[model samples]
Structure formats: C-alpha cells, structure tokens
Target: MLQVLSSESAQEILSTLTSDPGTASEIANSVDQSVQNVSYHLDRLCEADLITPTKTWYSQKGREMTVYALATERLVVQFSDSTD
Candidate 1:
C-alpha cells in the first residue's frame, strides 16, 4: 500500500477517500478527471489494499454503485532531513 502511495494519482485518490466514500464518478467530478482515469486510480488503490468498495444503492437511479473509501485512518509519509 505504501508503494502505491508513491504515485501522484494514488495519493490524490486516497485523499479524496479519506474525506468520504465515493463512486468513481463522484471522485472524477471532484478531481476534474475522467471516469476512466478515476477508475484506473481506484484500481491501483484497491490492489494496494489501501481502499475498499462498499456496495451501495443509488436511490435516485435505483441502482447499485460501488463506493470506495480508505481502509485505514493512518497515512504513511516518508521524508528526508539530511542536507549535504
């Protein structure tokens, strides 16, 4: 999961999920990205075990949609303080 966090898109996805679980469409809209692009990022996050999808019913459409959210609250960060 930490490895996936290295990617910029993955990081952005995680940040969005941290706020709330959302469908690929919702995420794309928020980030001003295409649905396919958001789906690709979501797949990587899912593969890394960083996010999970919840089966939800969209009342307005009366259809099921998968909402993705962060699997955990703890986010990992790596930094270097060395100056040479």
Candidate 2:
C-alpha cells in the first residue's frame, strides 16, 4: 500500500478523483496521461484499496465504463513499535 501511495501518478489520480468520480479515460485526461498509463495506476490503486468502482456507465458506442472514486476521504498511517 505504501509503495502504491508513493507513486506520483497514483497521487495525481487520487487528487483528480477528489473533485469528481470518473472513468479511466476521464482521469487520464484530467491528469494529462495516457489511458493505458492511467489504467495501470488505477489497477494499482484498486489493489491498494485506495480507490473503488462506484458505478458503471456506457459510452455512445455501448462500451461499459467503470467510474472510480476514492474508497476513503482520508488516510491515516501509523507505525508500531517492534519492541512490544
């Protein structure tokens, strides 16, 4: 999770989602990245539980598009002492 959060692309994606939930293409456009690149980061973000598919929409061509939003509004990280 930390590794995923450490990425600049991932951070940008998260930031983009804050204003609106969008499909991969929408996110890519907002971030000025390629769709493929955005999809890769979206997958990583999903695996990290940072984002989730909130709804599904269809394009005029009838292709299914998954809209993604942040799983949580805030994230808190804590480290435990090994000496316990």
Candidate 3:
C-alpha cells in the first residue's frame, strides 16, 4: 500500500475516496483532474487493494456509476528496532 501511495496523484485520489465513495468522473471533478487520468489511477488503486467498488448507481443521463471506497480505514507501520 505504501508503494502504491507513493504517487502524489494516487494519494490525492485515495484521500477523496476515504471521505466518501464516488465514481471515476466524480473523483476527477473533486480532484480537479481529467476523467481519463482519474480512471487510470482508480484502476491502479483497485489493483493494489487500496480501494474497492462499494455501490452502483445511475447518473442523471442514465449512465451507470460505480463508487469506490477505501478498502482499509487505517494502516500502521512500525519498523523493527533490531540491530544487525
């Protein structure tokens, strides 16, 4: 997850998803990015198990929307203190 979050754009996207689930377009709008770019990052995020499809709904124009939310609410990392 740390590796995946290394990307600044990915971090922005993840922050939005954490607040609430939204479709790619919605995320793009919220993040002030192109839909295409947001969609690409969404795919990577899903692959990394950082987010998951939570619900499906329809747009005003009848387009289906898939919303994604954070897969893990919180993560903690602690490095070992061993001397080698």
What is each predicted model's overall lDDT from 0 to 1?
0.82, 0.97, 0.89
Candidate 1 all-Cα RMSD:
3.9
**For model 1, what is the alpha-carbon lDDT of residue 45?**
87
Candidate 3: C-alpha lDDT: 0.89
- Model 2, 1-84: lDDT tens per residue? 999989999999999999999999999999999999999999999999999999999999999999999999999999999997
The per-residue C-alpha lDDT of model 2 at residue 50 equals 96
Q: Residue-wise lDDT of candidate 1 within 37-75, one digit each (tens)?
A: 889989988888788887774858687778888888895
- After TM-score superposition, the amount by which residue 68's alpha carbon in candidate 3 deviates from its true location, in angstroms, is 0.6
Q: Which ten-residue region of model 3 has the weakest summed lDDT?
A: 75-84
Predicted structure 1, TM vs. truth: 0.77
TM-score of each: 0.77, 0.92, 0.87
**Candidate 3 segments exceeding 4 Å error:** 81-84
Give the best candidate by lDDT. 2
The candidate with the higher lDDT, 1 or 2, is: 2
Task: State residue 23's C-alpha deviation in candidate 3, in Å.
Answer: 1.0
